[model samples]
Target: MRQPSRQGVEQALDRVMRVVTRTPLLPMGHGGAQAWIKAESLQRGGAFKLRGAYNRMVQIAPEDRPRGVVAFSSGNHAQGVARAARLLEMPAIIVMPADAPAVKLAGTRALGAEIVTYDRATESREAIAADLAARRGAVLVPSFDDVDVVEGQGTAGLEIAAALGHVPARVIVPCGGGGLAAGIALALPDAEIVVVEPEGWDDMRRSLELGHIVEVPADAPPTACDALQSRRVADITFGALHAAGARGVAVSEAEIRAAMRFAFAHGLVVEPGGAVALAAWLAGRLTDDGAETVIVCSGSNIDPAAFAAVLQEEK
Candidate 1:
């Protein structure tokens, strides 16, 4: 039940810097309002997940590292952990949804991690991962539930602050299990934190509005954002975001698609989930009051065919 702190994020930044690349903060403008995009879509492992994944695994004791690690992610976290484990020379077993995007599945596999497919609807990935870890005597690394992971994810926020040479007035982030959003909240205590999610899957939005954690509906509609389909928000993430006075918003599918197109137009490839924050901004769901803002472009792991179809729609 340890809470992530700014100090921990700083330490994590120092540790992850050895492996995590410093992605660019691209300048962008829309409707006369200006913002910076933290293109984590260019990060190693194609997302910011590597920062947390590496920070968590690198802390494992030498005696325990040999047993390897077990984790469950829709896709991004799987690749992150797999890449980190590969760097650390430790084995990784990822429990992934059977229907995860082929690009993500292939990416994790290519990184040399063993994948265990699961039925996301009828089965519990957490249970599968826990049992797998217990049976194999491996460590369990929850995507957003671990303090180390949250702290590690905060490194991006630290970089944002450092690059801007001052704290931004606001930061917009895509929320899955709320890991990245919560991490940024801890990193930029004075900044306004805005968490965005796909419409039907905005449990975190409802949770913050209700002042309690809530589960995604059993009948939530399908979304292209496989990476943001987390069923529930973790206490660790919820606590940090709630304490930071963070607010949440949900964007429509059309908005997400539009944001992806916007990123592409800007010469960046952003997956649907990664574009939700930009979606919110572009759709004017959040007011652009001229304050300095940073919109996080979190990932870019879309399947080529699917991405092509999306692009074709614009043509």
Candidate 2:
């Protein structure tokens, strides 16, 4: 597949803006440091996934739409595809991990998509989704690997630049399969890209450091960032980020929880996965040289109980 381009991202922005919400770019200051938060957590479907999902589904050929679409995601992407399919009047089947948070499962189901659950530790979600799509003659919409999806996700970067009136010196994005980071890199070519991931599942970080794709360790510790738990980094996403000279950092569970609290204190709701970028920033993993910076608050789909518990933790 061809690599996504800025032109492709621009085209995707035009297509997605009609459906995706233009989330806010809020200013945040810590001590003497100032940064802007791209509040994608406030986006429709409670995440930025909708931008790419809608962008991809909207392009399905008319005749092909009848076959519908199939996808695999822990939760955010499932809801994204489900919402997009509903908007486009297409059937959607989502293969999700059985252990995904109840809120995410319920959210996706509420959007009217058929759900297929599998064991994340023992089964491959990609295999299941691909098989289901092949059998049903439906389109397989990957969470982050497709060119259109990457371009669609890039629309967020476009919005960031447009809001700032110039490219920020840097952008910190949470890394899952690297779609958001890659997309933003393409969108803000002049800015430095930094990806943040959960400590045990920092495959993208390791891949960037090693100059090759790397898979998360088989015995990786469990993390609360379910949305950022891709076992391997995809070539498409890695390629885009590597070319953009992106760097990465991994944050601990404690740091993620703290970041969530920080966001809440600021009147924003952030999921664990979505809070990693902010965690990195708050933990001093990334320096603030007074250069303009943007940190993406990617999602806000945590269950009420889970979010409450995190908020109650001591700082």
Candidate 3:
């Protein structure tokens, strides 16, 4: 497989930026650091995943496009794939966790994608997606691993640098499967990129340490940040992250909850995944201890119950 070079990723990002909104980078008000939030939570379909979904869709062969596409995702990616398919007038089948967030599930369905619920314990989503693609003669679009996906994700980095006049001293991204961090690194080859994740769900941290992809076992008391559940790191992400000299860090669940509450209290509707960067910042990684930092608030699909709890806690 060819390497997913920074230049290639930049071109992909260029393609996405033309269609997606430039999410804002508002500073953290606590005066702790030069804090900025790339509010991808406000993106079309409510996540940055749309960029990758659409980027991949646009490149599909016209003959293949008629056969449609299939994907497995718990949230944002499902929404992205569905929305992208809608734009291309292609049929889509989204395999999602039965326990997936209602807001996300409904949004994907609303985009005209047929939904297939899978039993997380009894079924393999990958197998389901593969089977669906085969039966329908459709294309399979992985949530994160693919090179086109990473390139699409990189568009955020491209916009970030352009939005900020250039890469700042550091850019902090909320990492689940590593695509976000991988994309940003390629888009801003000159800036340092860091991956921030929840304490127990840090695949990028373990992957970088092991010098290869690593998986977190399924029995780890599942975290509710559904979009952050990519268990394996992608090869393309590995190369881009390594080339950019990326680093990984984790913040506690308590801190993440607090960050979500803080953002909402300040009129920002960030979900747990969206607030990961802010959570890391609150954990002192982004503190001015003193330096400027950009954090990507990548999604905004908070469960109403969880949102209430986030607000209730830290009191």
The TM-score ranking, best first, is 2, 1, 3
lDDT of each residue in 114-229, candidate 1, tens digit only: 99999988999999999999999999999999999999999999999999999999999999999999999999999999999999999999999999999999899989999899
Q: Rate the local accuracy (lDDT) of all candidates.
A: 0.95, 0.95, 0.83
TM-score of each: 0.99, 0.99, 0.95
- Measured over all alpha carbons after superposition, the RMSD of each candidate to the real structure, in angstroms, is 0.8, 0.7, 1.5
Q: Model 3 lDDT vs. the true structure?
A: 0.83
Model 3 lDDT-worst window of ten: 283-292
Q: Please identify model 2 stretches exceeding 4 Å from their true place.
A: none
Sorted by lDDT (best first), the order is 2, 1, 3
- Cα lDDT for residue 93, candidate 1: 99
How do the residues 33-149 of candidate 3 rate in per-residue lDDT, one tens digit apiece?
A: 457788998898888999988888889988889899999999899999998898889999999999998888999999999999999788899999999999899999988888888
Candidate 2 displacement at residue 232 in angstroms: 0.6
Task: Please give the lDDT score at residue 125 for candidate 2.
Answer: 93
